[model samples]
Target: MVEKVDLLIKNGYVVTMDKEGRLFKNGAVAVSGNRIVAVDKTSSIEQKYSAERVIDATGKIVMPGIVVSHCHTHGQASMGMPAEVEMENFYDELAKWWWPFLEDQLKKEDVYALAKYAITEIAKNGVTTVDDVMEAPKDLPGVLDAEGKAFLEVGMRGILAFEATERISKENGKLGIQENVNFIKKWNDKPDALLRGVMCVHTVFSCSPEMLKEVKELADKYNAWINLHVEESMYEVEYSKKHFGKLPFEHLRDIGFLGPNVLAAQCVNTSDKEIKILKEYDVKVSHNIQTNMVIGVGLAPVPKMIDEGITVSLGNDGFYLDMFETIRTVYITHKGVLKDQSVLPPKKVLEMATIDGARAVGLENDIGSLEVGKKADIIVVDLNEPVPLNNSNIYGNIVSFGMGKNVKYTIIDGKIVVENQKVLTVDEEKVRKEAYDATVRIWTRNGFL
Candidate 1:
């Protein structure tokens, strides 16, 4: 007798982000509960497992859902504010814009409404997982509470960390650490909770040595992931040189901050010595190609870092959350920056979005691939729109030509979160309205409007 399946995605091209990088034509993926149980020939899977729910993915590319490693989603409401005329550095950008918006204008009710809005938009873009470094208030307990409630209400897979910075009094540092610990304790071992606690020290330049050590120790005590920004710009690199007499990465290494448990968001200004130290310390890199190019920061040495056996995942920073653009940026930027055409191939770029991204968030074993025993987190892209089949190099073509509109469905943890380009969780129109309203309020409060 054949085994039963809860859901089956039938007759699609399955892209498996496995060690061998497998792609199966006319494939069928069977899911039992949250885990994928089989990937085989369509006819064979139908013969073996009876599906309770079936999705006809004909002429669509079924692949792993996008995983965003690091992002300031706490500022999702303030995304499109007009650029200030006198913006000088990243610190200025955060302090003048993002920080004040979070501290002053962001209402308690707005957290849930905006979170739902952000998650809806993100899911529509086929992003199933995100590591949201939330902006915590310097003197407010309610802000942290509101953020936790927002995460719980959305019911999405995410890593939430407090955005710790010493821009305020040193007492806020202790409060930030306590907030992380309290949140971790509350949701420590919940089976169905997809939210994980993380330690986020904004960046090396913004954090004092005491602040960095405190958060690191707290993270270790709770066994949570340490997410930090490093070498994101030339200014940060220069600041470290001026202040600590060492490069930023070296300063982190000397202070014993870089580790396997840490996810360094950006290293746009990293030196060869920094990359070597990163490899030695087993730190993961989250490459935000779009953000780097937008800010005119120097491009990361991605090809060299990958060749050195370092894992580099794709991220969008604070702007666009689309992985397709991120993947394209990785491919185009590296080739152009290196003056070498063979820098980041399509297959490798795809890996960075899928498997490598999963590894960055510490969930590679669960999702990130169409493999048995993995969670059925997948997206089906409609290929019929931009017709004229190119099956010969379809994988490469999908990366080059595919957009979020092509995503016909987004499945997360065995549940279809999006179908036919519509979000299943929240009211789309309401969320969009809330996002717009929040944006206006944030701008007015920050005097940006």
Candidate 2:
């Protein structure tokens, strides 16, 4: 008298990533609709339930889908623009090239293609959920809707917002504020929405204290997440001391801006005292290891943050969407800097990409792990290794060798969104062409042609 389910993934090494760090050597996950009905040994699942679809995950790794804690998918189209220019420092790069030539040049019409193309790329790499901040100040009103349409088209999960700030004119900043409110209003009560909204600010340097408090109030009203960059560069620390006579996180704390709702990205220039403040407020850190290096910013003290018991998660910062690289970089970079190979082990890095990430977006109960009654967001990775891939060595092998191409299947919400390294929700060829068209249109406007 076995029950029937929609999908049963069998005979794979299932990394549960639960509190006990469970691993089923020959595991199966039974899905009923969008929820996981059971997770146990394959033989147990075979006796307990029958499925409409069964995937034989032989020689593959079955785990929770990667959750990107921070992203700027809008910048996907601007990749490699101003190719000949050297970015000497963080502020100049953003002020001169990134903010002006890219965010300013991006038009409303280009949102869908860039978002779709970028989201699709991340999806195929086993990213089921992403928290994104759009920066198109030139087209603020209703532009987040365009991003929503792109997420809907791809059938992935997104927490969307326009990075609201007062760096521009106060009027434009008000527009940014209104845009976030509008988006949040639409997603007010939809807890299970495939596309959700978060309130975003660019940085403390870019946003006023009053503006920061305003966003916090609205975000609390909706119980929504608030994301922003903090201590991503040394300039922010210097700016705070010169203006407010305190460190940056202290400024946030004094203004009553530090809270559990905040997902702060890149604590690269933060001190140990700042880490304590972050822990006090229960703020989560989104580590952008590669982006910090590429932008010439200092490395985040992720090892210290983790050691201090703060929830540190991994993000691309939208410089690149490769989750494998993000995971690997965090694994190796900290060890090199600390000169301690024991720091940021593969297992911890795996948690940063999955459960810790879910915690960052406040979706830990839903999407982060492969547990019973959780959302069925999972990835089947085929490392294609010639050696043994057991539970003891699996975490290391995947972290060391995994790539987008190795992701043979990406299952999100009981639906197969990507299979055989191809995205199934949208037309790949069509997206490629439109994405290129949008990039060209943007580049032409930026005078990069």
Candidate 3:
């Protein structure tokens, strides 16, 4: 008997970022409900299954939807203000601009509006999943819920968290914890939930040891995922050593906080020993290439980490929503830094953006690849340019020439969230206008205007 499926995407070059790295020309993917049922040659899929809806992907590149491991949902509206701060270094930017804006000016509506706006852009850019850290302690009671509402309205998958920190005050930190724990309890087990909550302790410098231990206990109690920054700057390491008499990762490990469920962002300043510790504990890493360079922090030893069998995933870190740009940046940045063109090949970089990212978020079996039984999170890239997109040159073309704008379709959970480069879940223009108005209000209140 012929099988019935919900959707069939046919006649494209499919890059299955699977365990064996399979790529099939004239390919097709069949979906049923929210799961992919089959991925094979177009002729085979056509003969075996009839779909309710079929997408003719002629002259396109069919691939798994991109995964973003780290970003701040709160920064979408207030992105450019950091450039206006006139900071000489990372510490200056954080202390003078970033913290003050979050503490004083951020509001509940701003969080909701900007999160919807950012998720709209992310969907259009073919990113199906995002690991987002939400701040704005002053508006903590319902801030994560506001962001969660935005995520639901935008129809994107997200692992959300409130960044718990002691930099502002212990009371504020307690509120942050409350926000995250409440959100996690509210959404972590909701059926068919596209947005789930995780635990976030902002960074080692901003979190006391007691706070870290409490966060860990909360995460363990709820069996939640943990996301945080680890040694993103020299100042963080210095602060940890001066205060705790150990490095940041060392202290985290000692406190029993580092684990397989923890996703550490920007190990830019990790020493060799620290990297070993990360490996020893099986903690994942999120590499934000553009943000690190923009902040003038040193480059992370990604290639070395990968060699050490540590899983390093790619993230834009709210610097940009375009994962294609991030993929290209990861491809070339390491080559330029190492002066070896052979380092970090296109396939490996693409893997970091897809499957490795899924692994980082503990969802590898669900959404990372174009395989049977995985979530139908996929994208169709328009490859109608003059250059031919074939098996031999597919990876190079995708890394070197692909842009987020080239994505013609973004399918999440077997549903078309973005078609023809436009988001289907929300009013794009309304979201943009609200984001701009919120930014103006925030900037004016923060004295930036």
Candidate 4:
């Protein structure tokens, strides 16, 4: 008896990204509805199941789609804004100006338009999932719905949150948290939802100890994930020492805020002790290498974190919004920083982008790998490079040569969201235009233009 499925993708080099690290030179994946039904040799899948839609992936690499563990989609439209030379430093650029000027000026429609544009480009870049923190206190209450609409329009899986903090005022902080509460109740209360909600705080200094514990309680009540920036800047570390008399991670541990469900975004200034603390709590780290370096923040001890049994995952941080660039950077940056070529190999960095990323976002069991009974979030990479892609060098070659522009197909939840480099879920150009106009509105209103 033949088992029928919704989609069949065959005749490609399949990288399963499984724990066993299975790769097949001539592999196939069968999807029914939203789950993977079969992943094996092409002949085996072809014999056991027939599919309604077939995608021939000859001369391509079939693999799980990229997962971005952290990003601010609202920053999409602000790319290349506020000429960099004018700012004194990162603190002046972000805390004194950017957050105060940009984040507060964001309207509900700006969140929708910019998030749509960012997610669309990320999907085209073979990213199937994201954990996004939208920081718009002024557009609170129902602002999360705006970004949720963008995720829906792009047809990407995501964990959305509003960054709750008291940097402005305690009441604004309350509004920020209420947005996350509303979003979680509306979107994540149900089972097997494509779009979900999580709890977030801006940073250690931005939120008080009471606010942090309160956020944790809400996450626990909903059984949801908690995410936040952890020592992302030197300012945060200095603040911790001056105010709390301990490191930031240590303060979290002392306060019972470090847990498996907590996804720490950037530990750029963490020490060995802090890394051990994170390992003790099984807290996941989302590493945005490019932003850390570009902003003059010290490079994170990523190699040390990995060595200490902490899971470090890749996130673009809305900077190029390209995971291929992030994977390549993660693969090379640590080696350059530590001057050791053996650390953070291509396979490990790729895992940081895929399976480890899913784990960081608490979705490892569902969508990280290409396995039976898992969600069908996959991409077909076109091997147009001159180098030969074989079993021995497949991982190396993909990490070194794979470009998101060459991804021929991007399938999410067994649906063809992007096929042949053309997005099907929404009009790509229209959303791009919408994002441009929205940014203009924000800047003009804030008088930054």
Candidate 5:
């Protein structure tokens, strides 16, 4: 009475970072179309289900593919732009570099090209899902439209949010919110869509209370999520304290903006009280450990937050496309900062990259762990390389020494997006050339090269 498997991956060491954290040696996973129907010993699976296609993952580790909790992949072509010379203050970094780049220099062709390139890049690194928090122009720019189009073209599963702001004026905030509403309406009912809609209020500092409520209402009406940056730096905490007589999270709690649907990125400056508030509101945190270290911001209290029942997930924070590097950074940085090797165990960090990240994006039941009735978003890593295959500490090797180069395959929703380190959905070379050329042009146009 056994059903046939559409695909079977045999002879791999499977690390199912499920709630129970199970591991199976010499295991096989039988996939019935998009869902993993069975995970058992290799001998048992071979006896039960016949496979149309078989992947010999011998001497490899099979696990859930990574989900990047927050990424601005639309900025792939803006990689090398100079840090603003006059950006002494936090707000100035936005005005001089990020906002101007979005408003003045980017073209539609560039957004399309950049998105195409970013999708392939992340997939090659074994990342199957990403939350692209795109900051579109104040007016609906051609490039912003193309960014969405490119995401659709690349066939990457994601949630797209138009970064909304009231910084220019109250009218501009309403316009930004409307843009989000329009995009959400366009794709709300599409079945089998890899993309979902989100309303991104840029940050608490940039949006007015009315605009925040409007965004919340729009997201609720569409049953979509709201993504935003919160407590990213020291000044953000001070600004909230000065303006509202409370910390940043306290301000959000008072205004009723903290909710399960709200994804708050980068709580690097959050206090213990703020962590408690986050746990109460069920707010998810996208911990960008590398970006914080690079930007000289203090480390996030991730272990404390995790202990407080706040769901902390890993994010790249626009630093690199490789999720492996991000995972390594989180594991090492938290341990170093806390002065305890036992702070963030490898198993916990692995969960952050997989299941916890899916929970942050509210897709836990659909595609996090490799379980029955869940979408087969899986990656195959070659363990015969520098990654030692010793069974004594295979889990530690994966988090510490595993690199993106070791990833041999990436599958999303039962479809092979990357095989043998090559992207199947698009021309990799063409996209890379376009991204590089566009970066040069955008930089020259802005006089920042």
Candidate 6:
């Protein structure tokens, strides 16, 4: 008897980023009801399973969907604007430009519109799962809800949060916390929802110790993942020492806030002792390579972190949504900084983008790699390489030559979200127009227009 499946993808080179690193030249994946039923050689899958829909992935590379451990869905509006500013460092840019722009000019409509636009771009870039931090304290009441709506409309999977910070005011901080809590309670029980809520503390400098403790307690109560920035700049470390009388990681550890569920971004200035503490607590790190490079923050000690058995994953950090560029940046950044060509091999970088990233976001068993019974989050990349794409050259081609524009299909939760490089769930042009209008409004409000 033949088994029936909802979809069958065949005739591709499948890179199953599993524990054993399995690869099949002529491969196929069978999906049934949002779960992968089987992954095997194309002939075997074709003979055993009959499907209602089939995607002939000829001359394509099929792999697990890219996972972004940290991103800012609301920062899409500020993408190109930061580049034009001549600033000394990240702190200067944040204080003189970015923070003022966000706190004063960002509106509710801007959040919603930018989210739709961001998710659309992310889907096109082959990112299926994202951990998004929404930071617009001025637009708090339903800001997260609006972003959630955008994610649902775009048919992408996301773990969303409102970055609660006490720097603005006690009332504003309370509102931010309430926003995250309310969104979590509202969506946590929903059946088969694609977007869920996570807890976010902006940073140690912005969030008081009390606020951090309270957020940690809330995460513990709800059993949720906590995403936050940690030691992203020298200023943050200096501030932590000045205020808390200890390093940021030390203070966090002393407060009992470090844990396996915490996803800390940046860590560019972490010390050896701090790295040890991170390893001891098993906290995950989200490496935003492009953002760090663009902002001139020092490179993260990823090679050392990996050696210590720390879980480090790739993230865009709202700099750009393209995971392909992120992967390449991570690959070459470490190599160039360390002056060693052997660091960060292509295969390892790919793993960071996919499997390691899923683990960072606490979705390892569900959506990381192409495994049976895992959620069907997959992408098809058209290599379009001049040289032959075989087992040995596949990773090199992906890292060096591939771009997000080469993504032909993005599938999330057994649904085709992007087909032929176009988003299917939302109106692309309308989203783009609204995003542009919102950007203009925000720029005008900030006097940048």
Screening candidate 6 with a backbone cut-off below 3 angstroms (N, C-alpha, C), the clashing residue pairs are none
In Å, residue 163's CA in model 4 sits off its true spot by: 0.5
The residue ranges of model 6 lying beyond 4 angstroms of the native Cα positions read 82-89
Q: Write the per-residue lDDT of candidate 5 for residues 1-449, one digit (tens) a residue.
A: 66677889889998887877777789888888788898888898888888778999999999999999998766775666675568776667677877787544656676667777887888899998888766555435333457667766655777777677877778767776777777777776774567777788887778877777788777888888888998788888888788878888898888878789888999988999888899999999999988777767778999999999888998886558888899998989878877899988888888899999999998898888988788888899985655446556877899988888889989888887888998888888888898888788777777766
Looking at model 1, report the run of 10 residues with the lowest lDDT sum.
135-144
Residue 23 in candidate 1, Cα distance off native in Å: 1.5
Cα-lDDT of candidate 3: 0.89
The lDDT for every candidate, in the order shown, is 0.78, 0.88, 0.89, 0.88, 0.81, 0.89
Off by over 4 Å in 2: 83-88
CA shift of 341, model 1, Å: 1.7
- Which regions of candidate 5 are displaced past 4 Å? 102-104, 138-145, 385-392
Lowest-lDDT window of 10 residues in candidate 3?
76-85
lDDT of 2 by residue, 1-449 (tens): 99999999999999988888989989999999899999999999999999878999988889999999988887777677764556666888788788877888777778878888888999999999998888788887988999899998898889898888777777788888788888888985776678788888999889988888988888888788899999888889999999989999999999988889899998899999999999999999999888899778889988888988999988897767889988988888888888999998899999999999999988999999999999999999888889887778988988888887899899888899999988888899999889899999998887777
lDDT of 1 by residue, 262-379 (tens): 9998888889988899899888999998878777777888898999989899887746867787777788878887889888788888888889999987788888888999988889
TM-score, candidate 2, is 0.98
Better of 2 and 3 by TM-score: 2
Q: How close is candidate 4 to the true structure, as a TM-score?
A: 0.98
lDDT of 6 by residue, 1-449 (tens): 78999999999999999998898889999999999999999999988998889999989999999999998876777766643556786678777777787645777888889888988998998999988988888877998888888888898898998889887798999999989899889887774778788888888988888999999999999888899999899999999999989999999999999999999999999999999999999999999988787778778999999989999999888768888988998898789889999998898889899999999998898888999999999999997876777899888788887799999999999999999899998889999999999988887887777
Q: Is candidate 2 or candidate 5 better by lDDT?
A: 2
Name the candidate, 1 or 6, with the larger lDDT value.
6
What lDDT does candidate 1 reach at residue 266?
83
